[model samples]
Target: MRKKGFTLIELIISMAIIAILAAILVPNISSYIKKANNEKAKDIAAIVFSNSMRSYMKDGKFQREDVLNNINEDLNIKDNEVDVASLYDSEITVDFKVSKLEYEVKIDGEQSRYDFKQK
Candidate 1:
């Protein structure tokens, strides 16, 4: 009589297929994860820039330290959750123009940059 369960050769073939599929997928998954992190960093930069502009409008001046503190408070984010400051390489810059305010932030490792102008 034929065996009711998978034979040794059948099991080996199945395991080999699984391993091949995993090898193909693992690198793709890691690249996707890296892209997601970059996007997240960009989003964080936007938030920081917006907050800086808002603080400037409210107080008539840009205060980096104050804006960061307010961001932590308003977002209810603790240091352990995510260090928002660490996402960027340097501080946000605000330039005053005749009719608009320009803000720029550089992402960590110089991977990306965010610029916004408000009139």
Candidate 2:
């Protein structure tokens, strides 16, 4: 004459297992999110660099204001999965060189730099 429901001990064990799994997964999930954001920032920065270079080639001059505007536009686009602009700590910096283009993207207080050499 035994019941078909789970015992109290079984329920407690299941709850404990769920809690342990959550503890293990939560931090990993957050870290992955941070990493993904960082990567997204990097991609945005690269695109900015590429667009600036193309504009420079087309116009025969590099405009800092235009580059900044492009950065804003790219980050604010509605198609983006994440609001990358919010993650940035400060305005992006672009440095134009005679034979190279350099840009820095700051996210979460870390700076990621990229260099593009002219061919």
Candidate 3:
């Protein structure tokens, strides 16, 4: 009588297929997760910057360090910067650039940039 269970060749083939599928999917899933995290980080950073800027305006002064500090405090980030340069951290480095009302943020090594203007 023929065996009811999978043969060695069939098992090997199934495993090979699974491995191929994982190889194809793992990288795409990883990239999507990284992109999602970066998006969330950027959104939080933007909100922090906006609120800090409003506070600075209301108080009739502008101090990048103070604003950054306050924003960090509010956001529970230990180290943050508001310079028109790179802000490095353990997992990512965020670069900030502002010219007049235009502002840009480059997160990590991604080419995608977030830009905004202050009114």
Candidate 4:
């Protein structure tokens, strides 16, 4: 009678193929996941910076470092100084500064300033 199931050699070949595919795909998948996480970090940083800056303006503490506590804890941001004068004025052209490698965010404007450094 002919065999109905795969032979041992056939099974081994199939497993080998699966392993090869996994080897190639796993790194790519990991890299994509890392990139996604980094993007999420950036978004969180932006929100934190903007909120802190707004709070500073509203509280009349534009030059004070006391604005850091306004951000939520989940963002994992640390205290850092934001130089509003250097960042704003008529010379200022951008609202934010982001560094993916350093995981830093800076918000620049006339009313307030904020610095976020990831930990």
Candidate 5:
């Protein structure tokens, strides 16, 4: 009588199927994870924008260093992962980069850019 259990060939076939599925799914999952990370970085940049607006309301001025410092303090933005540049109303352009995503929030609502690159 045959044992009521998987045969060696059956076990090997199941493992092969699992490996093939993994090989097909891994790259798609990886791509999705990278997209999610990029979106999270953009969310942080939006937080920076809100903080800048709040600071402007309070101080009647917008300064790059001050806003960046507030983000570091109030929002606990990681210093090593983010950098700020020329992000004030008085400035012609606002540039803030978090992780690999760069955003330019323009006062005139024109000439803004959001792009990803290795940093």
Candidate 6:
């Protein structure tokens, strides 16, 4: 007479198969998340650049940290900061720099995604 349940060998084999599948899938999922974060960071960088340009035109100065909330109001963005933990592991910051005749917008921790000078 035999029991109806799976044998120990069968269960172990099934568990090993699941483990292998997880090993393969986990990294892929992580990579996908990182790619998504990079894409989001790029898009946000563009928005920040344009926002800075607009603010500079209207206010004669670059957007500063203190006025980020006001910019958020003008832009209707959810918040002054962004969180992309998959790539940056912290909230992304929108920083600005101004020279005599130009302003720069930088997304902290994500300089590679920034390209404000492009047409």
> Compared with the true structure, what per-residue lDDT tens digits does model 3 show for residues 1-119?
87588889999999999999999999999898866656665566576555455544554443445556666666665452344333432112233322222234433323223354332
**Model 4 worst lDDT run, 10 consecutive residues:** 88-97
Score residue 25 of candidate 5 by CA lDDT: 100
TM accuracy, model 3: 0.55
* Model 2 ranges with Cα > 4 A deviation: 64-119
Q: Judged by lDDT against the true structure, how good is candidate 5? A: 0.61
List clashing residue pairs in candidate 5: none
To one decimal, what is the Cα RMSD in angstroms of model 1 from the true structure?
10.7
Candidate with better lDDT, 1 vs 3: 1
lDDT of each: 0.53, 0.50, 0.51, 0.53, 0.61, 0.49
What TM-score goes with each of the models? 0.60, 0.55, 0.55, 0.59, 0.62, 0.60
Q: List candidate 5 segments past 4 Å from native.
A: 1-8, 87-89, 92-119
State how far residue 53 of model 3 sits from its true place (Å). Answer: 0.8
Model 1 residue pairs with clashes: none
Q: Alpha carbon lDDT of residue 4, candidate 3? A: 88
On TM-score, the leading prediction is 5
- Cα distance off (Å), candidate 4, residue 58: 1.2
Question: Model 1, which residues run further than 4 Å from truth?
Answer: 80-119
Best candidate, lDDT: 5
| Candidate 1 vs candidate 3, TM-score winner | 1
Instruction: Count clashing pairs, candidate 6.
Output: 0
List the candidate numbers ranked by lDDT, top first.
Answer: 5, 1, 4, 3, 2, 6
> In model 3, what is the error at residue 77, expressed in angstroms?
0.7
Residue-level lDDT for 54 in candidate 4: 60
Count residue pairs with overlapping backbones in model 1.
Answer: 0
TM-score, candidate 1, is 0.60
